[model samples]
Target: MIWDNNFAVSIFPILLQGLWVTVQITLLGTLLAAVLGLVFAVLRRLAIPVLSQVVSFLVVFVRGTPLLVQAYVAFFVLPAYGVSFNALTTGIVVIGVNYSAYMAEVYRSGIQGVPKGQWEAATALSLPGVRTWGRIILPQAIRTVVPMLGNYLIQMFKDSAVLSAITVVELMATAQAIGSSSFRYIEPLTLAALLFLAVSYPASRLVNRLERRYAPQH
Candidate 1:
């Protein structure tokens, strides 16, 4: 049934709309994740008395939980407490927050990966903390982690399909809707997989290049 040309034509445009939504969520969610993850890394690195402890606990909690459970709670549970976000906003926030824990670890690895001598030299020069981090540390740290962060962004893009569970009309959700109505899951589902593969395969290649390019030259 799916091999029918007209059905393919009708489905392509619809899938494109779903793809756009997926892209939007991935972009915004990645932005939030990058910023929040960096903040978490800093807080934990700083090790301030209470704040650091709190951040540590949060990172563990978020990482330990399932993303789907997190999403369901954000969408379904919060509204009962008079807290509510629309499905798009809810999906974006949950994805961002969920990924933040993992990114924070990536950032921490990057920060720790920096040569200790660089930190010691900055301190010997009497550089303020902000100046040391901004002018020296973050520049090197971010570069070291760029490939890793890029990989995570690709991962997040694929994971955005999970948001469809909450009524976000992303790629998988669109496919599900089409399948439900037409009682034909094959074409729509295959189209979604191909769309994901189209984006992710090239991205995987790019990440591989970045990893090689950034690999420490012994």
Candidate 2:
């Protein structure tokens, strides 16, 4: 038969195993991106003459480069300098750092969205710099940031497929391996695409809901 039901059924479990790895990469990468992005945003927001300029340039550089090249450097070149990690670890870190540049911009916008009155209030009360940001600025800023972060999470989930090139054995990689070994492409590839849609579609909807919920009132 052109499309073998039994073969597809047999490989479903294996594909799921790969899907789990993809999920792991997505979750860990998004977490890393969110934290690192905040750091980048804050550094820039501080507007320290040297530090802010350096951070801004680095963010721009990362945003300008292609993710595949970044992955290649991390997986292939870093080892010569003794900065090697396992394939999955390298993939997660590369993906996280790559997305961090974009997330930094998102965070900056959210931070800028905060009302000037809040800053004045903190200054008037003699709140420490750390406390002003930690208690007042970040909480209000993060409410706006949450929905954008969720959207990035979904994007990263889909982008995890690119890491398959580094031998991460994520869902796309698993499907490709199955196709190569069995010389059958349609079933596994189609199923993999379906699995991606299954997760991303719902996540997108949730992000929309969050955006509406957190949207600033006019």
Which numbered prediction scores highest in TM-score against the true structure?
Answer: 2
- The number of clashing residue pairs in each candidate reads 0, 0
Which window of ten consecutive residues has the lowest lDDT sum in model 2?
A: 209-218
Q: Write the per-residue lDDT of candidate 2 for residues 1-218, one digit (tens) a residue.
A: 78889988999999999999999999999999999999999999999999999999999999999888899999999999999889999999999999999999999998899999999999999999999999999998888888899999999999999999989999999999999999999999988999999999999999999999988652
RMSD of each: 1.4, 1.1
Tens digits of per-residue lDDT for model 1, 114-161: 889889999999999999999988888888788888898899999999
TM-score of candidate 1 relative to the true fold = 0.95
Q: Which stretches of candidate 2 lie over 4 Å from their true place?
A: none
Per-candidate local distance difference test: 0.92, 0.94
Candidate 1: give the clashing pairs: none
lDDT of the structure predicted as candidate 2: 0.94
Candidate with best lDDT: 2
Error of 2 at 71 (Å): 0.3
Q: What's the TM-score of each model vs. the native?
A: 0.95, 0.97
